[model samples]
Target: MLDANLKQQLQGLLTNLREPIELVSSLGDDAKSVELASLLDDIAALSDKVSVTRADDDARRPSFLIRRASDAQVAVRFAGIPMGHEFTSLVLALLQVGGHPPKVAPEVLEQVAALDGDYHFETYFSLSCQNCPDIVQALNLMSVVNPRITHTAIDGGLFQAEVEDRKIMAVPTIFLNGETFGQGRMELEQILAKLDSGAEAKAAEKIAAKDAFDVLVVGGGPAGAAAAIYAARKGIRVGLAAERFGGQVLDTMGIENFISVQHTEGPKLVAQLEQHVKDYDVDIMNLQRAEKLIPAKTEGGLHEVKLASGASLKARTVILSTGARWRQLGVPGEDEYRNKGVAYCPHCDGPLYKGKRVAVIGGGNSGVEAAIDLAGLVAHVTLIEFDSELRADAVLQRKLASLPNVKIITSALTTEVLGDGEKVMGLSYKDRNKDELHQIELEGVFVQIGLVPNTEWLKDSVTLSRHGEIEVDHRGETSQAGIFAAGDCTTVPYKQIVIAMGEGSKAALSAFDYMIRLPADVEAEAA
Candidate 1:
């Protein structure tokens, strides 16, 4: 199951093991079980400190536990083959269990160890999900730190019955003590904040004590990272407060269009951007959501930005790059059936609807791509587009046409989601051709319409367009002089990563120029 190149890499990584660890597997004679056993054997062959044993103790077949030989309480379980996006999680579990320290911060390690409650976490994940590995790895790290906190990462693709029973249509859904905990992509700080309420108040106090920055970048997407890095390189006090450090890019999958890089994944690029930013002197604050933007009361004065955690930051010039979020279908039952049957990420949640009929709402690149991807896994894919024709590229349209299981409907708008107070049953649409309503029976609905700018918080602060995007000039300056905006949240077109980065750098430079041109008295007072 493991290739030679990968085995060589794993062998090098396993050399970091300071202590012995055992892989206790509960497998059967099934094909998947045999594959899992083969993988376990290959892993054990790399290092003498690693060993594998069979003991069908877990109710979930083909499951395994990575337990520290010296400390049995420290264990993390995986209920299926941890390949695809989850391969990283598996490797992390091995190194962590083998006494290699995790990459988490020290304070977070303390917080994990200090937790007192019994948290039996079961995370339902899909192998193709780009966001599931973070949740799995975070929980695994917590389990290794606090024995009371145990985690089991279950592959929803393998346990189809359990997924159906739980009405789970999304990836990375977590259950704590048999109750729903959270869904979607979550970082370590976000997870810690949920379990440790005091952590928020503590973080707020720490943020409140910080001095005013010369340049403060709000949002932590590509634009925000670029802005922060550019400002920091100018030898100024730069601070970045982000709701989540990768932002929407974390949910993205393939990235073939990013310039110079040839091809890469979203998370991988975000990591490099973050590392580059960290190489500078920027003060980074993660998991900090901006609730309100209080522009500078006067010219050349500090602009105060308030956060959701009762913390406020003051900066001479602020760069808004909060970016955008997935646009939702406003139809009835859509919100109610979210995660139950309605999902937005086809790459992440496609496997959950294996052999099931589904509908893709939209005809753009994302929508058609989703239909094409889903056609291979689901029984049927009905693509409904609001436009008269598909707006996807010719190549994509050709590929979509080649798929035999896909059906396209043009000039139709999704009217309502049909559900039986549980999961999705079908959807109601309006046919422009006949001026009549239509309904299609399907088990799931994947909405890939597009994205909306994350500028709701700036509605009362800055000049916003009719579509809620921040109105910006050519210099990346917003309506306010000292405040600027960039990326998908601004008036920038294309909404590509490269464009965001360039705009971010321009906004930083503009802010610097604005700062230098301040009144002499204001400059002296600011100094």
Candidate 2:
């Protein structure tokens, strides 16, 4: 079950195990169970400290638990084959359970250890989902850290009956104590905040007591990472506040156009970006949302940034790279049925709708690509476009046309997401050419329209374009003095990762220039 290269790598990693560990599997006679047993045997053969056992915690077949042989309390489990994106999760669980210390921050580890009450977390995930690995790994680590917490990462594709019973149409749906906790991507910090009520307030108090930074970068995308690193390299105090470290990049599927890098996935690139930024002395404020941006009362004065945590940070210069999010089709029932039938990620949720009819909205590259990807797993795909013709590249259009299970409809506007109050039943759309309204019965709706700038919070603070993007000059400087913006949140023509990194660097340089030219008295006072 394990390839030669993978076995070699796992052999090297397993040698780091400081203690013995056991793989307790509850499997059946199914093919997947046999495959899992083979994989477990391969793993046990890799290291002397590893062994396999039997356990019957649940009826789910082909599942196993990785526990310290000395103590079963410190354990984590996988309810399916932990391959694809979840392979890393499996490796981390093995290492962590085998007595190899995790690399998480000291404070985060303490928080996990301090968590009280019983936390039996069950997370549903798809193999292709880029966002699910983080959730699974986080919960797995938490379960290992605290005896009260137990996490089981279940594969939604393998257990269709449970998924249907729960009405889970999205990937990474989490349940705590048999009740819904959250859906979609969430960070460990965010999870702790929700579980530990005082976590937010304590974090806020710590942030409020910090000294004013020389540069405060808002947003944790590639642009924000670049800006923070550039500023920190100057030996200046830099603080970065963001909702999540990766921003929209976490949702992106595959990236091939990044310069120098031949090919990569969004989550992998984000991990690299975050690690590089951490190499510097920059202070990172994770899982923080900037609620408002206040300009300095004077030309060379401190600027204030209010956060949703009820904390504020002051900085001499502020760089905005909040980025953009997937644009929603603002139609009736769209909000009500979100995650019930309406989804924005094709790669993550496509597997859950196997052999089921689905609709893809938009005619751009993303839409065409989603249609192509879904045509293989789903029974049929209907591509709906508001444009008179497809706006995707000719190559993509040609490939989409060759698919037998795909049906394209141009000049169509999505009107309402038809649902039965519990789940999606179908959708209604308008034909622009014939002025006729039509409805299509589908089990799922994949939206790939485009992106909207995450500038709603800045609307009352800065000058925004008519389309709501932050307006900026050539140097990435915004309308406000000593304030700059970059990436998809700005009026930049292209929204590529490489371009965003370049713009972020330029914005950092511009901020440095602006600081140097400030009045001598102001500089001294700031210093």
Q: Rate the local accuracy (lDDT) of all candidates.
A: 0.94, 0.94
- Please give each candidate's TM-score: 0.99, 0.99
Question: Residue 489 CA error for candidate 2 (Å)?
Answer: 0.6
Window of ten residues with lowest summed lDDT in model 2: 53-62
As a whole number from 0 to 100, the lDDT of residue 173 in candidate 2 is 98
Question: What lDDT tens digits, residue by residue, belong to model 1 across residues 125-200?
Answer: 9988999998999999999999999999999999999988987889989999999999998988888889998999
Residue 19's C-alpha lDDT in candidate 1? 88
Q: Assess the local accuracy of residue 228 in candidate 2 as a C-alpha lDDT between 0 and 100.
A: 94
Q: How many clashes (backbone atoms < 3 Å, residues ≥3 apart in a chain or on different chains) does model 2 have?
A: 0
Residue pairs in clash, model 2: none
